[model samples]
Target chain A: MKAVVTVTGTDRKGIIAQVSAFLSEKNINILDISQTIMRDRFAMIMVVDASECTEDLASLASSAAEMGKDIGMSVRVQHEDIFQAMHRV
Target chain B: MFNSTEVIETIDMIEKEHLDIRTVTMGISLLPCVRESAEQTAQAVYERVVRSAERLVPTVGQLSREYGIPIVNKRVSVTPVSLVTAAFPEQSPLVARALDRAADALGIDFLGGYSALVHKATADYEQKFLATIPEALAVTQKLCASVNVGSSRSGINMDAVRQMGGIVKQTAESTQGGMGCARLVAFCNAVEDNPFMAGAFHGVGEADRVINVGVSGPGVVQHALSFAPEADLTEAAEIIKRTAFKITRAGQLVAKEAARRLGVPFGVVDLSLAPTPARGDSVAHILEELGLEVVGGHGTTAALAMLNDAVKKGGVMASSRVGGLSGAFIPVSEDIGMIEAAERGAVTIDKLEAMTCVCSVGLDMIALPGDTPASTISAILADEAAIGMVNNKTTAVRVIPAPGKKVGDTVDFGGLLGRAPVMPVHCGSAEKFISRGGILPAPIHSFKN
Candidate 1:
């Protein structure tokens, strides 16, 4: 039960804070976090352990998406297996 | 471990490129459902399908949500109705209706296996069953029917082909603007475990209940090609194979999960790059993306041959179970790019027939003028079947002769079946040839013992 969350938008203050707050609220643990802002475009990727999350993965995804919408960023949460299967043997 | 770029790539494929599991088909054997009376058999068919496929939609929804990948269709394919109704004959439509009702009850969009395998000859009951297809399909919203008029081993059944030509027209004439014609397929070398429709059927050899998956990612492959537009054909082939691997792996995951949750034995992952009506999700567009000015240009078949081979080469290793029509589909009405190509006269029936020689299937979802004769349709089937038989592959025809419509007009089925512009058929007649009904003997190479 792991998921990958991606956030992309124009750089703004507290984008990570907002996203982290939503994840923590769902009891999802942050396993890894990477973020960078290049020429005003902010891109962040987070890997989270969702097995122990209070909410379902789909619900958490929608919550993050809604929060990202409020902050004018595009956000997506997808199962880690899809990426693993695509990129690895 | 996957890097962030790889993660985003997978997400983008699903989100923007319309990557999806085209179908999760549960093949239910209704051999056990046959009763002495057709009415009783129909009832048994209803109960058996409902019992077997009760959780299909809900399970598919759960899996779709869990993986965040769209499962576009949840379907069921039963044992071919001809075998079940071999004794009952005239009352087979009852079984078709019952299956349709079961589909409605299960909330599935379509159900296949209202079919007959008359490649050699037809039984009395099969002949009676064939006559009910137009009525059965026109009456039911989700029932699909297919007839195997030819096979590599047994040769082409010209009698069945001729009958099917009239039946195809009858199917169209029965429905408004020939929409029912969209749901029937005539095939040479039809497979047992196809998960896609309008051609899926649970062959007699299939197990009782098994889950078969058809995965699609035309846009994903097309997007991958866009990254290396200047690459040579070899490099392009490498890129397509890699992309197809990734797509098939995702499909394997979904198929395994869907089967696990539904408690059905996993059958196979059909690695077809099935396209939709959407703009980016088209096989024709993929060919255009590979450097063709249009999908039906001079080098289109070469491009498709590479694509089809690359898809199989990549997909073969991604899953232990793989079957069905696992290649690129260029159904005209179902693809926006193909529809556009046909409209512009860049893709013709002749060109499509040529393309089918290299691809997995043939002559899918094309439209012809309303007045096109039945014999012409039979001729089309004969030609397509010859290619499949000689080449040792599967080929099919699903043409709609739009009633009261002519070339330059359009026929729209809406939703996934999509739209088509009427393309003209050859002016010549094949009446004498088709009327001389007999078996076109199996290809000489078919004897490989």
Candidate 2:
């Protein structure tokens, strides 16, 4: 199943690189990603297919949270359906 | 994949400036579904709307997500229930219930058409529907109701206006202010092509099906203002024209896709920059950034006139089908900057009326002092309606008379209505003028071929 990972919090350098590296390590292919810095906060939404990832979403989410903690960010992983329901039409 | 500056501007506006197509409304004429039994009529109305608008919300939502443009409201406007219910006046309440149920089943945000155009004279059904407005409005959810009691062509219907004054009060009282008169709009010279809620209705002469779009870009205009603060009048006009063109283009694209998906004819695109309570997303702020401390200053009316005209010109050029009251709005409570200006005494009722002469609607979302006589409110509506009728334009009133609010008392309507300080009305009773019950004759231009 595909999932959407949204990372939001304080803006910091190399946060994107760190998150991308973690996803790549687990073989998660990022289908699409968009990021923006509004005022002093940074927000990123990434769509990724989780089937290719050897690690399940729980492991990925835990690792993502650790990565977020390292950079003072908040990371959330939601199924594609849920994301679409909330953000999509 | 689009490299053009205009495309980039459009994309950027939707992404960052909070610019989006506000509503994609399906105008379904409900006149054909009349029946002897109210229940059967209601069932027919429901089936027709469900069949017509079955894919409306889903299609709009899909397109909105795909394009990353937030389509905030998906709505439907039908033939005025007063006229439709006229076939069965005894079932007026049942008709209202039917509309409410139809809207609920379709998942539309608001269904408009509980309306009567009684500027000249009221039919039997119209009068009955008018009497049941408070009950109808209170009982229905997701159904907006409006009444056009007067127009310049028919002049002010003093009796209808008088009755409406009491109806509005009763409606508010019945709803316990939960709806806060938001779902009810009193209009003079109401337009047939209005795509916005609380006044939108599919006219009798309209086709069986049509799709109309209401596009909003207050934030985009505000962003454009930042680019040309010192630009001359011509330059400012060009900037506004260009921005409006891009915004209208977005609406055009959405409308085409929506109509294609729904298998219906694409109707008009209403280019009105309706502002919310969000920061940096107000039309009045755009005026303020254009060198006015407040939006109703000496130069404010001229500036708004230019902006309104330029927007129309640009929008008309972008879309072959442009209708509705396609102009800028300065509704005080809905716009943060306007609310602040009202608090600061920079915007007043008279000044707002002058602005409406150039802008789209009139005296929208304004809060008057509680004790201001109902006659004065009626006169305000009459005067504003006169402006619309004389100029051959659409004008409406959505004023709020907060029961206990006094002059200078700030009332926070919270979200959408924003927070507004009660602005003082011109101290005088318009009772004499409004009480003279006679139809103001139609304007000269109304006698067209």
Note the Cα lDDT for every prediction shown.
0.91, 0.78
Candidate 2 lDDT over residue span B1-449, tens digit each: 11123233444576679887889999998878988788888888888888889888878877775454688899999988888778676567787778888888888888988888888887777888888888888888778888887666676676777777667666666775434466778887787778997789887777888999998888888798798878998988888887788778778778887898899898899988889888878988888777887777799998788888888887787776998889998888888888778877988888999999998887788877666677777777778878878887778887767677789787677765687777888887778877786777787778776
- Model 2, residue B175: displacement in angstroms? 1.8
Candidate 2 segments exceeding 4 Å error: A1-89, B4-8, B151-153, B178-180
* Clashing residue pairs found in predicted model 1: none
User: lDDT, candidate 1, residue B312?
Assistant: 95
After TM-score superposition, the amount by which residue B433's alpha carbon in candidate 2 deviates from its true location, in angstroms, is 2.9
Worst 10 residues of 2 chain B by lDDT: B1-10
Residues B1-449, model 1: lDDT tens digits: 55767776777788889999899999999999879899999999999999999999998887777677899999999899999999987888999999999999999989999999999988788888899999999889999999999899999999999999999999989998899988899999999999999999999999999999999999999999999989999999999999899999988998888889888999999989999999999999999988999989899999999999999999999988999999999899999999999999999999999999999899999888899999999999999999988898999999999999999999999999899999999898999999999999998889988
